[model samples]
Target: MSKSLNTLFAALLLSSAGNVLAASSVDLTVKGLITPSACEPTLSNGGVVDIGKISAKDLNADQETHLPSQYLQLGVTCDAATLMALEATDNREGSNFADDMAHFGLGLTNDSEKLGGMELRIVDPIADGVSPWIIGLQNGSSTWIRSYYFARDNILSVANTGGAIPIPVQQFTSSLRINPIIAPTSGLTLNNEVAIDGSVTLTVIYL
Candidate 1:
């Protein structure tokens, strides 16, 4: 089972990693509880990167297609700074350039064909003063602690890390850089159409 903030309308490329068959269709679902903390998170461009029209012939058969780096901003603003930690839930898990959990799966290539993987990196963290009080178990309250960009602790995960100690600030901002990799086209069967369906959800935990 995988996760998605929203179902991916299209996949980057559609082809079998090998000969694995794809399902006719898959369902997408999200579950969470809303709170009164008054905090909201947003992504620039709805978190989609337009690589434009890429011709299969232009793609390399021996090497994977590593697109030019795409960028997006992830920010959170609150009516009143609250204590919370953010985590990333992979809608399509275990699908990556490698078996890297930091990277997310790109879903099936097409008709059961397998696609490639992508990763989200945290950079340039800017929180209000007195913010980032370090996020820990809810049982124990935390104090203010700030982390610079690319801190391993800031790598969003279901557990500790990606989140920091909750600081009492109304706004928290950061740069979310996405690295998407397209597997080589040599082995894949090119059809008339292909899709790039990758979805991920960034959720906050009130600690």
Candidate 2:
């Protein structure tokens, strides 16, 4: 082969080798755990209740269940400072006397920001033979109930700047009160014998 042709061939081979080396690549990997198992609510009763069994009459007594005073206090812990709003719901599948009220209070760490606000909701199943009721609040003042219906749903929204925020890396406590009402016709006793096995799902949106 000619000298020029040989030089050209050598150059082409070098370029091809460089291209091969440049084409080399590495495998990339990413992983995480989403929606790890949620912790179940610890029932007032000793037995652990499944989420599905929350509204069954078999679990509850014939009488009404009064809201626990302790429920008026709830607390949440997180890695960073956050603003929280909450809503409460009942799974009263098809009872005639399923009614409830939820009260809430927010507490934050010393250096934390002020509370933006919160909302609460109560619901009654249509299959139940009673009417529904609603109560709400905003900026720390309670609002009047607008509607009442049997076996319907109710909602309340509350907001307050009066509450303080906690310091960074510190834990804070909040509280809520839930009261259930029963219809007179259901023959349900208001003796507070009722049992409640429900979960309160709280969604905290950081502002």
Candidate 3:
């Protein structure tokens, strides 16, 4: 073959190889922009109460009996969109031990423009010596009570009440509703923001 023809052929092969290499090579660039909104009305502090430690003697006997009430009101804050829900569990592994005894209701008020017509509810209350009382008051009225029973073989039986109410071999449940405004005379005005906080009082009459 002629040298000129060989040079032309070599140039064509080199160009084809370059094209194949270019096709095999991959180059990519990815870009993204994200913006997040700031959080509002940062969560304020609150409080909690453990019913197990509360003794029956601390009630009417002590002048400072109100201590439990104070502890109950510690960190309670309710919003119109997000209501509070409370749960009480009595898990005693002994042969004859009653569950916790307690009563609860809601207290509400709206004094800010950011919220109005507040409402609360009693989600659950595991009372002792009686059935489980799960009911909410319209405006913190008509306290719901329940008797605690002993757990035997993972089953709870209501304690005997001198022929008052029969003991059930299972757990009980109850519910209640809380309305911020019960009377027509009660109207809320939230100029900036509404805040609701209160304490729960539990009066236990031990057997």
Candidate 4:
């Protein structure tokens, strides 16, 4: 996540107002890079996985309960070989009450209680023969580094040093390991049935 990668892209804002300068001739141009390649990301289950139903008895009274680790295939396919990365945006922001950036919350209870959170990780990334690197641009700051292991805080970059990497192939694959947990029974105000709701949105960011 060096500045080379962090500053790879930026948005330009143009503002025009202030009486329009008495209708004088003014030229405002718009520019952007439009690449021939496009990429899309998807989950094997159409982004849904059912964990069945959990009874209060299933949770430990003294500690949080980790339901189980579910593994799903995450893939990104491009129209052609393209330099790209996958960006994940947490849909349920700030709901988890957890301090881990890679983990997000499960929404609220009837009493406005924080249910818990879930964590996502990328395991065993596979592209043609190149090893892609996971990057966290440090909150889009000027200093950052690439990560081989991914958390919610990082971006899955092509690991191109200074510029973009024309992928060797049009497809990339990886395992998305989902770990959802229930808060400790003692810490929650769960006197009745509650539903666990967690979500995330992923997009392919072409560099």
RMSD of every candidate to native, in Å, equals 16.7, 19.5, 24.1, 9.9
Which lDDT tens digits does candidate 4 get at residues 67-106? 8988889888888887676777778777685657767778
Worst 10 residues of 3 by lDDT: 91-100
Q: lDDT values of the candidates?
A: 0.60, 0.32, 0.28, 0.71
lDDT (10s digit) by residue, model 3, range 1-207: 699999999997987984565445577999764323211111112323223343333333212122322211112222221212233222211111111132222223343211112122333333332433332222233432332221111111122433323232222223332232111212323233223232332221111
Best by the TM-score measure:
4
Ranking 1 against 4 by TM-score, winner: 4
**How well does candidate 2 match the true structure in TM-score terms?**
0.30
Model 4 segments more than 4 A misplaced: 1-31, 129-133, 142-144, 148-153, 160-169
How far in Å is the alpha carbon of 5 misplaced in model 4? Answer: 37
Task: Sort every candidate by lDDT, greatest first.
Answer: 4, 1, 2, 3
In order of appearance, the predictions have TM-scores of 0.61, 0.30, 0.21, 0.74
lDDT of model 1 at position 82: 73
Q: Of the pair 2 and 4, which is ahead by TM-score?
A: 4
Give the winner by lDDT: 1 or 2. Answer: 1
Model 2 lDDT on a 0 to 1 scale: 0.32
TM-score of model number 4:
0.74
Off by over 4 Å in 2: 1-72, 93-170, 185-199, 205-207
User: 59, model 3: CA deviation in Å?
Assistant: 38
